[model samples]
Structure formats: structure tokens, C-alpha cells
Target: MDAILRAAGEVLGTELSEPVDLGGSPRTVVLRCRTASGGSVVVKKYGTEPDDLRAFTAEAAGLSLRLAGPELLGVDDSIPLLVMEDLGSAPTLADVLLGNDPQAALDGLSAWARGLGRLAVASVHRRADLAALSAGYGMGVPSWDEEPWLLRHAAEFPAALAGIGVEAPPELAGELERIAATGANEYLAFTPGDTCPDNNLLTPDGLRLIDFESACYLPVFMTAAYCRMPFATCWCVFTLPAGLAEKIEETYRTEVVEAYPQLVEDEIWQPGIRRAVALWTVYLTTNLIPRMAKDEPAHRTRRPVPTLRQLLRHRWETASTLEEFPAFAETMRLLLRDVAGDWDVPPLPGYPAFGDFG
Candidate 1:
């Protein structure tokens, strides 16, 4: 804690005091503090491990891009800390979805979708910057040309499935292999590596993204697809009322086409988006199972991983809505049946539990 204040002071050129722990994993220290001048700021200090340093650098690189996010106040690579203006005390959309009125939650979701779309448009001319940000980074969003990290995860999926008592079928194994080989390069754009609602704030201006530890340039469809599924957040998978998701997609699509008309061609945009969504869904869903089922030190700091039954139920419900992908739907059906066994599943919570409204 002392180290964080000292780092903040060094970066801000003022003695920072009165820190409130903002919570973080083992590799991070997030604090909300007050400068000597009485201004509020957030101080994020990353550990010195190779992966940790890379994550911090990637975050700083991401902030350098003119995406829809918090203002980048000051960054120090040596201390690996970022000091920035606090975005106020508004609760995140995740909190709103858990406890606010349905309309308010819907409003926040709309803002998040629109914010991401704007980010896509803003990144249209930042190709060189995005490449520089990604160069030599230890970890980043998986893309076609560079994907060693995702390949490692693919290799572990079969064992992850086995840990939960489900035998991996040959077809499932083959699908995983196929996904590893596929890439979504043509539609690359800046993506918030982690699109969970927890990483954004519901300010009066709209949703403002906070963390960029995981942000990178990836297929624009990755964000669009994740906005519909709980792939990024994993814990909170609220079922939107019918047609609401499509409306949100349209909001995003309109913004992108306005920025880059060349991408609107039917052959390029439609199939690329759908295929990207499917590939991402498969990768995320497979990767989440083992992590969600087992408790680890990292999971201890965050929300408890949902039970296998809960995840299977969520997956099944999500798959049912994707009727266009019958094969994937069939796979979910098979997995759901295996997971159901004889136990009665619990009911999912109703939408809009708490948080900001206006």
C-alpha cells in the first residue's frame, strides 16, 4: 500500500494520500486515492513479473489510442503504474443489471454497445499504432497472424472437459482443432480485450471504459459478438428481452459502416462477423469451463466461478437463441444433457437488479 502511494506521488508530482483499495488480482494493485491538491485519481501498479510487465505496457499502449475510454493522465513504465482522473462514483453496468430497473439496465447496455462502436470507428486509421502496441507484447487478443496464447488454451481444452466428468467426443476435439486453425484477420479493429460490464462506468455522458489491461486490436465482430454472449464477463449472463440484442447490433453496425464503407460489402461483412462470433464463442466457452468449475487463488479475488450446472444451463439457453447455427446448437444440446444429469437447476435472476438509472 505504501509503495502505491509513493508511486502515485512520484507520477503526479504531489503527495497522494487516503487510498481506498479498489481490489485486484495477485498481479495488480488498484487504488483510488486523493492527491495533495484534493483531486481524485486512480493508481494502478503492476507487478514486476514478465507477464505482469507486458500487461501493464499493453494497457498503456491501449490508452494511447484515441478510443472511448478514461483520460490518460500520466504513465510510468519503470514503476508500471498509471495515474488518471477518476471517472466519478457511478456503478458499472454489471451492478445495474444485477439491481436496477429493467429500462435503466437496457439503457446502460445501449450505451456500452454504442461506445464500443465508436471505438471501432475511431480506430479505423490507427493501424500502425495498433501494430506498434502489439509488437512483442507477451499477451493480447488472439488474431489470425499471431495466436500462440490461444493455441496453448486449445491444447488444454480436452483435459479441461475431462476434469468436469464429461468425456470429450472426437467431434468436439476436431472442432477445437479447426477453431485453432481459423483466424479473423480481415475484420480487425480495436477490441476491449475484456468487455465485461465491470470494466466500464455508467456516467451521465454514457458508458466509459476503465481497464485496458486486456485491450488490443482484434476483429470488430469479437466485441459485437461478446456483447450478446457472456463470453467476456463469464459470471453475469443476463438474458436480454427479445429483439433488444439485434437493436444493439444495429446501433454498432451503423456506426462502423459510417466510418468504413468498404467493409459493408455483403461478402466481406456478413459472413466475417457471424464466423468470428462462432469461433470466439467456441474458444471462450471451452476455456471457461475448467476455470469456472475449480477454485483458484485468482478466482478468490473475483466473483466465484459459477457452478457447472449453471454454466451448462446458461450455455444451453444461449445456444437455443442462436438457431442459425444448428450444429453449434446441437453441440450445446448434447453438452447440456450431459451436464443436467438428474439434478434440478436453479432459476436465473430477473434482469435489472440495481444501480444508476438516468
Candidate 2:
């Protein structure tokens, strides 16, 4: 912490005070500092790695050009720190959503959507800058769809099924097999890979997107898709006050379609949303199982063994067969077949193209 303060003070040309801990994920330690010129700043310290430094720099540059986040005061390479305007007053979108107030949640979601739209439009012409930041960063687009991490969810199916005290219908496995057979890629626009409500800061003035550690250029659907699962979970769990869920969903759907007219059709939106949900389910399930095993062993008996089983069951019950989520299911199926070898599965549709956006 002292090292961070000293480094930040040098970079900001100021005398920094002792660091204050703002405990959260990734173990962030913050400091309140004053420049020699009497300007106040906040510094955040994370691990020292080239990728981490690059993300900080890219976020600083991206936010500096827009009104979407805190100002980038400066960056210190020595301590791998970021100095910026102190936004202690800002509340994360997660906080607002958890309030369970319909109006507040809708407002926060609207703000988040608009902020994402701004980022996407602004990035269209900044390809060069984005390219440079992504170069050799080991954080570019995934070459294949079936990421190994996703298999962790597949492994959890047995546990989740047992926990739920139900056997997955044979149809569920069939759908999984079908999803593994179709491989396709469609480019939309860039988005932060982890654009959850928790990553957005809601200030009195407006919403400020935070945490660019997972930022990358990808299909615009990636944002809406990645974001939908949390929104769905939140809606499902809270039941919204009155008919607010319908209104919020309408608002989100309309805004997303208006912002990217190319995906107004179900053919595009359906697949995108499904892929987003399935992938996110796998992500959440995988993380949940390990955490459950360690911190909540008592609950483990009720927890899903194979994370994907719960997700698959949920998908089958809530959504139509994989036939309904064509593109997304196909992508998953293809990825699985590639990784796990061929399995007996019914024929599936060919990948559909929404034309080239690039």
C-alpha cells in the first residue's frame, strides 16, 4: 500500500496520504492523494502485470474521451497503479438493482444500456487504438466457441440433477449434442466481456461503466447477450414490483433493436440472447459449484453436481428445444463435438448469416 501511494504521488506530482482499503473482488486497495498543485486524486492498486497495466491504460483512454466514467488522472507503471478522480459517491448498478425498487432498477438498466450504446458507437472508428491494446494481450477473440471453462459446467450436470432430485430428460442430452455440431461466427461490435450490473457505477449525475479488465472487441450482441442472464435472474428472483418486468424488457428490447437495427429479427436476437444465456449459465454454474464446495458444504447436497445440468434443465423447461435458439445452440453443440468427439445426434440447421457488418 505504501509503495502504491508513493508511486501515485510521483506520477501525479503530489503528496499522497496513506492508502485506504475499499475491499472487493480482485483485491483492490485505494488511496486518497493530493497533488502539489492542490488537486485531489484517487489511486487504485492491483497486481503488476503487463495485461493489467494495459487494461488500465485502455480504460483510462476510453473513459477520458467520453463522459461515461471517472477521469484518468495518471498511471504509474512501477506500482501498477491507476490514479483518477475520486468517485466515492457513486453506487454500483448492482446496488441499485438489489434495492428491488422497480423504478430504480429500470432507471439503472436504462442508464446502463445507453452507456453501452455510447461505447459501441464510439469504438467503431477507434479500431486502430483497440487493435494496438489487444495486440499480444492474450485477450483477443476466442478462436473456437467451446472454451474449456465451459466444460466445468458440463461436469456439474450430475450434481445439479441430483440436487434437484430429478433425472434430465433424454431430450436435454440430445439438444446438447445438436448444439455441438454447428459452428459460426458473426461480428457485431466491441463490448466489455463482463458487463454485469456490478461493474457499472451509478453516480448522481449518471451511470459510469467501470472495470475494463475484460474489455474487448466483439459482436454488439455480446453485450446484450452477456447482460441478459443477470437481468433475467434478477427479474426471476425479485418478480419486479407490479408489471415493471414487462416494461423493462420492452425498454431493453426496443433500445437494443433501435441501436442496432440489423438484429431486430428473431433470427438474430433469439440466437444471440440464447447463446448469451447458455454461456453465462455455464460461467455462473462453474463458479457457483466450487464456491459451494468450499464455503457452503451444507448446501452442497442441494447444489447441482454438473452445473450444465441445471442450466440445461432450466433451458429446456423455460425455453423451447435448441431448435428455438438455433444459432446459439448450434455454436455450443459444435464446440462440444470438437472437444468431446462425435456423439449420436439428430440433424440441425445450418448457420445463418446476418450479412457482414464490417
- Clash number by candidate, in order: 5, 18
Report each candidate's C-alpha RMSD, comma-separated, in the order given. 4.4, 10.7
TM-score of 2: 0.65
Tens-place lDDT digits, model 2, residues 1-358:
6677778878877678745555433545666665566556777775545445555545544444443456777765455667888776576666665553546766786778777766676565554555454442323333112233334454555445446343444454444433322222444455554566666788887777666544555555546643443343221122234444344444455655554676668777767666555545444543444443222222223211122223333333333334565543443443344422332322221111111111
Best by lDDT: 1
TM-score of each: 0.82, 0.65
Cα lDDT listed for each candidate? 0.66, 0.50
Candidate 1 wrongly placed segments (more than 4 Å): 134-148, 163-165, 180-183, 260-274, 291-308, 320-331, 353-358
lDDT of 1 at 84: 74
Q: Superposing every Cα of model 1 onto the true structure, what RMSD results? A: 4.4
lDDT tens per residue, model 1, 36-85: 88888888899887667766866777777757567778877767788877
Say which candidate scores most in TM-score: 1
Model 1: how far residue 141 lies from native, Å:
14
The TM-score, computed over Cα atoms with residue i paired to residue i, of candidate 1 is 0.82
